[model samples]
Target: MDLRQLQYLVAVAEEGSVRRAARRLYMAQPPLSQALLRLERDLGVELFTRTSRGVILTDAGRELVGRARDILHQVEDARSAVQATAPDDSATLRIGAVAGPLSAGELTRPILEAFRALHPDVTVRLRDTSFADQVDLVASGVIDVALVRCPVVHDDVDVIPIAAEPRALFVRSTHELASEQTLSVDDVIEYPMLGLDAPEWFSSFWQLDPERGHSLVDTQLPPVSTVQGIQLALAAAPLVVTGCATMARFAPSPLIRAIELPDASPSIIGVAYRRGDTRPVVRSFLEAAASAAAENIALLPNATSSV
Candidate 1:
């Protein structure tokens, strides 16, 4: 009935028990149960079904939960919007980036510096999430901007190309390709190739296949979930993966080498956001990214061969 009650319902739904939700919400189980009972009575419907496993949402509860989450998010967005328009230093920009190249510290440093210089009051919060999640985050108003690989299929979002960078074969220092300055895709494919676990956007660069026997690598690995994983894989095994030239520039290990993949197309990195956002902070950041992209373009190697 009220935001507090709706909050309680959401908490119970997430925690899956009245006792657990009470613990989380800093209330007694009895009060939380009474609140749920009142909510159900006021709505004239049973929201949850009791079961041995846990509390499960009824059909109406399922629909109500979705709407309640939306309403809460909208309220949060309104609060953020008000804060966003305050003095420059009070503004916040939530940035979503896939955890390399653009998301890494080195590449973001200059842009963040420029952003701070331009709008010193604005606080920038960066999130390193998956490219697929970034799209939805932007569309849902969860993040102000997302810097990610191109070929994003979401039509509800607007994308601005930030840079086109070379795709290189990353390998451990002991790997045969480590000493080489350039590599053909065919040459690197001989070793067990470590690849990004992606469906289309990333897979297309390597010309991967869902159908059996059509992939270049003997094994397909999910994207390195952590930066340490990326470093370890490159140090221990021959990881023939594609990365932005900027990412390789920032990695801690000299053990890993970025060899030019002659047959792989360069990855196009860009900024994505909701189509209707007209905020000045968002506009300023986008401009800074565009400027940085222009200055950095010549740093990438040319890919002469096609995939």
Candidate 2:
């Protein structure tokens, strides 16, 4: 019925308990429960069924929760749009990037330099985020644009393909595969791969699924949420972390070795923004990014016969 009610519904659905949701929302349990009851009464449907453990969403609740999330996202976007146009802050451009490969100097720095060259008056702000969060940030207008790795299959955002670079397997220099000049997707999959705690679409792209029959090996290591997590995991074991060649070029870890995955398809990088965004700054940055990608295409990793 209202944004606050929708927020309460979403919080309850995510937290799975009225008491827990109340704690998360910084509100008392009674008021939160009362709000949920009022919402259900207005809608004439039972949103959740209470249990001793926690609340479970009824079939209608499951459907409504999805719609509620979308509505909340739009509401947030509207608020951000208005704030961006406030008299004092109209000249700022917000950019979001997934940690590691795309955020490195090789890709991000050049794009920033080009955009700034064209728009000297705008102040650019960068937000480093997980791969899973990049798309959401763009869609919710939290950032004007995002530099994201591909297989970004969301209808709410439009993606412009920038560059396609070869994929590599990163492992500790002391690992057996580290000495090899080239490896196959199959070879890399034999090791316990370090998985990322990212959206399925985002994570699947980095896994070389297209080249490897969409199969990834199991891992005992807990899933990592950021690039640093992947690096830390590699330092601790003989695990495999798949990424673009640019990552190998910029890595600070002397113990890490990036071996060419000749058989795997190259990873693609793209610029993503909300579908209907026509802001001049966003368009200018995207154009600059595309130009930078074109100029650096020759620098991308080349495929070779597996050794």
Candidate 3:
């Protein structure tokens, strides 16, 4: 289907109602509904199941929705890059690395400084964003590349997984569980949980089960968006925060402890770039990353952060 049709499909899927999607797209409801029907007919599959509550994506719709987001994000990036870049534009690479293990430790730290040393002439712009969600930043060309916590999830971006480290539970050192080097998910979940914003598949990374779905919440915890925020949170409340190896680095203070989760899903730390991107800088960054992971060499210079 054409981009217009794909856009309409995504809108309906996201908003869950034709009328709402129409409002979002600034279009009439009838045409949006007609467009949805046309798309389903052309694809030869039912995309959504209508119910009293709203619309739910069928299995096929769920699949197509991800594909649609990828296509649209790529198109938007292409348009932005072309329009924003002039022939004489300065050589700059915008990179986003989330705040945590992805940016703090062995793999990404060396690679960041290494990439800069290798391409000294290029201006590198760095931003610290929330975990995993940086895939959207890369696909949209808001940044040229990213180092982020895993399950990149978006098909339009490519991830080079550097390390598979177990998730950890962070708590105040004074907390009872702090002395334990490791803890079970059930034990960790019993405390008030501080959650990070991540994809649905990432709920487990937060020590939350899909079926359990934040059942451990004593009070709905405020959103902790960064490592600094999590640190601030520890001083304020007895909340259990879950993260990967980077969390360990943040735990040197007497205020916090990093407890291992051997049974938790192995947190995938990686570099992400737009799918099919082959610019020399991007390639160099990837090459550096592969070498870092292969050699397992680490130099602990922290990532440089910019707005």
Candidate 4:
């Protein structure tokens, strides 16, 4: 019925639990519950169905939550637009990037340069984050935009597909698979796999072990948190790491060998930002990213070979 009520509804929908939503909003549970009940009464529809785990949105709830987010984002954008008139308002654009192969200079630098060329007055800040944290960071307003790998699942964020890079398997040169020119997902899974500390959906796409239903937590090798950690694990053990071919080509170690996986799906690179973010600078950056991606893709090798 009102912005406050809409906020409550959206929060509950996102958190999927009244208690958690109330905690996030720094409000009492009783008032939040009362508010939702009043909203359901006014709308004459049950917004959520309570379950043992948490709550699930009904059809009406889903529709309302989608519009509510758009409205809230518009309100924030209106406030920001008015505030932009003040002389002291800073012109800094904060960007979050997942620390991995695609975050390398070869892919990111051109986009940065293109954005800078267009918006000379704006100062750009880059924050290095994990794949799991990128969507949350954008939704919470910690960053204006993010460059990440798919599949990102969040209703409050919008992802734009940029490019798809071929997948490859990284193994120690001493490993048996290292000498092989190409491999299949079945072949790579036999060795101890090096897993990254990333979100399940994000990591699953790169692992290509869905047929066996393998999980990174079940990996024999210890999980790594960064690209450097992955590199170290590869050099120290015969563990296999799977990722984009572009990343393997960038590896510094001669001891590491990257073998293509012809049967595996390519890793997708995408740009994401908060849904309904209508800022001019944000729009400009996205355009620049698109242009940069097109240019970069042209330079990429057509087929993945030994690296």
Q: Who wins the TM-score comparison?
A: 4
| lDDT tens digits by residue: candidate 2, 182-254 | 8887666645667777765556556544345453645677778776777888888877878877777776578
Q: Which stretches of candidate 2 lie over 4 Å from their true place?
A: 1-90, 210-219, 296-307
- In terms of lDDT, the poorest run of 10 residues in model 1 is 204-213
Name every residue pair that clashes in candidate 3. Answer: 101-246
Residue-level lDDT of model 1, residues 189-267, one tens digit each, is: 5556555544343443433222123455535455553445666766766566666565566664777777777555456
Report every candidate's CA lDDT.
Answer: 0.65, 0.74, 0.69, 0.74
Q: Worst 10-residue stretch by lDDT in candidate 2?
A: 298-307
Per-residue lDDT, model 3, residue 160, is: 74
- Return whichever of 2 and 4 wins on TM-score: 4
TM-score of model 1 vs. true structure: 0.57
After superposing all C-alphas onto the true structure, candidate 3 shows an RMSD in angstroms of: 9.7
Error of 2 at 214 (Å): 5.3
| Candidate 1 whole-model C-alpha lDDT, 0 to 1 | 0.65
Clashing pairs in 2: none
Q: After superposition, how far is residue 72 of candidate 1 from its true place, in Å?
A: 27
lDDT of 3 by residue, 1-307 (tens): 9876887788888898876875444334555677788999999999999888879999999999999999988886886476445454337888888773455366665676777788899898888777546667898878888877765545466677665666788888888888998787767656777766555434344645432443454345566666777777786777776777566764465678888877665566677887667567777887776666655533432222210
RMSD to native for every prediction? 14.0, 11.4, 9.7, 9.5
Regions of model 4 farther than 4 Å from truth: 1-90, 216-220, 303-307
**Candidate ordering by TM-score (highest first):** 4, 2, 3, 1
